[model samples]
Target: MKFDTIIIGGGLSGMTCAAMLAKNGQKVALVTAGQSCLHFNSGSIELLGFQEGKVVERPFEGIAQLNEAHPYRKIKTEKLAVYAEEARTLLAEAGLKMKGNAEKNHFRLSPIGTTIPAWLTLEDLITLETTAELNGKKLLLANVEGFLDWPTAYLSDSLSAMGANVKTASFTTEALAFARKSPTEMRAINIAKYLDKAQNIADAAREINRLGKGFDLVLLPAVLGLAHDNVDLLRKAVETPVECVATMPPSVSGIRIENKLRGFLGQHGAVVLNSDTVNNGFFEGDKLTAITTEKLEETRLEANQYVLGTGSFLSGGLVSDYQTITEPALHLEVEAHESRTQWTSEYLFDEQPYMAFGVKTTDDFHPMKDGKAVTNLYAIGSVLSGNSGIKQATGTGVSMLTAIAVAHNILNQ
Candidate 1:
């Protein structure tokens, strides 16, 4: 099999790159093992949420100050701004309605009630430029009766402390009640699956409307739009203004993004090998000639160019042992600590070195093998070394911008 580009890993980065290339008429193939980290997303894409232990109000400015090795440094700061806008437009074109820009970081309410800086937030979710936006307003937090993921008490206390009059309510429909019979399955994704029906949505809307009277805003868990966007349906059905807040993983909002992007790729004629793993890469000289997947066995899937967005240790992009870490797919050179002891920090909240450990790349995002650049293979997203995305709060931003930048590089060539 041959393609213009083969993307390993169908996470945000791989999907973004595939979508852009496929939209431009390039034949693309994306092989994904299973679910990506999108299942843990908070309904917000963050650029640079925190820098030097402080919240960043402007992300571009924060990016400018990032260390030389951070992935954002690979894309020129000026071009990053262009790619940021392009990224937003691409996502919007892919059917994701979002707000906020790369220049300014808005605040999204976290599952535990604190505010986190975000570059783009889902349109139906509540976002604030400042905490003062909550002052003197009435807010109602509504949750499913048996859903235990959303921390309502913490959110109420946080909102009340920020000068908002907050109230809490719980409601459940027959569908939701039926799901609650299994404690382990009462997650946001499962709840969303149960609520995909019109009757269930109407029942939920009726309950919320009864409890949400006179409230300025009704806040519900982000569990209404897994298969399709039922948030809009529920919103239109209820009289009160409704918005969604994120819940614990597996996040419904994140799954919605994954599904939408995967579907968009199909619509654009991209081949998506779902639940498939790329186990070996066929390299010749300094270039990756082709690759093989577990499902496709001996059949060599060839491409002119390939993208490795297989993610970090959590997603199995990189693996570690008692002695060393390695990029499992192609045995690409990884940037990590020499000793395992230096890979972590004694303090729990302190930044850990392993989060920044990934495949070493060049200025153009090409991975290196034996200290030489692999000409046709590029590594993007959390799979790239430098920048502990968790500490820097730049995971989604890096995933998106890097992917888009690489897509441009491939298109230009």
Candidate 2:
């Protein structure tokens, strides 16, 4: 079957591109072999240097500064700017909006706070992005009552800039409070306590609605509604529309982004496929046209465009354990070592996730062979290698941006 676009992975990055293309009225099919990594960590659509809707220079120069294993030591600054623009465009097209502007890095301390990295939020855009009713129209932010490390009034300031007069409500479920409670039972004191005080379904509804009075959104650390592998549950529990902003709790926001995107994409007609198994791929003069796997028994499909979003170590695109990337459809050249043993080691310095594995590409994120674009394919996300400097980096955001850039290349072509 012929398609306007064929995306191979089902991860956030891939799905982000597929969602945009499909939403814009493209015939797109997303393929994945199994589960995704989005649910594995906290969900933060972060940026290294983000503030007021712009992409600015980050203090950190390169990925090598963050970890020793970074494959390529540096990426040009101009390249990062292009990528930032691409990310913002992609999200905006798909209904997940963000700014492509420049600013400074803002990392939040935890239990739900905000960091104003260099990217910008709409000063007046925070009114109500969702359909759910907030505490009467004003946003209610709940965090540890006295948390010093947290980025306080961060998002609120941005929202206020947007004319969203919000109120802050400190609560006991702060990280410190939760830590004091028993590991298992602490949950009772936390999310459970929040629910119990409301007491009963009707009461819970009343409490959440009361809290939301004058607020159109509820900004909380990703903790409250992050259980049960679903973000929707929190909305159900709170009886109000919620935006589980973001926090540093091991990527809860990231996982939620993945879950929500997967379901949304499926409902919009994108096929998800993933697998550890390598399928035989065929190409003609460096252009991949077909692939063969056990499931399809050598079936092939044609496509007008390709967006490669195989992410970095976190996305499982490249690995030291596997020793080889197991070339997908293209027999593209990789920077593998002469001796597979030379590929990696147990040493932390040597085994840094940044280094050891990657698909070489140009600033445009298109794989290159002798300085020429490889077909109509656009490579994106962690697969490109480099550019993941610690200070001004957010993987999911990077993925979103890169996917946008790639889609821009594809659709415009």
Best by lDDT: 1
**Model 2 segments more than 4 A misplaced:** 49-101, 110-221, 226-252, 263-268, 274-278, 321-331, 336-356, 368-373, 389-394
Candidate 2 minimal-lDDT segment of 10 residues: 122-131
Question: Which residue runs of candidate 1 sit more than 4 Å off their true CA positions?
Answer: none
Q: What is the TM-score of each predicted model, taking all chains together?
A: 0.97, 0.59
Tens-place lDDT per residue, model 1, 178-255, is 898999779888898888888899999999999999999999999885787888899889998998999988898888
| 255: Cα error in model 2, Å | 2.9
**Count of backbone clashes, every candidate in sequence:** 0, 55
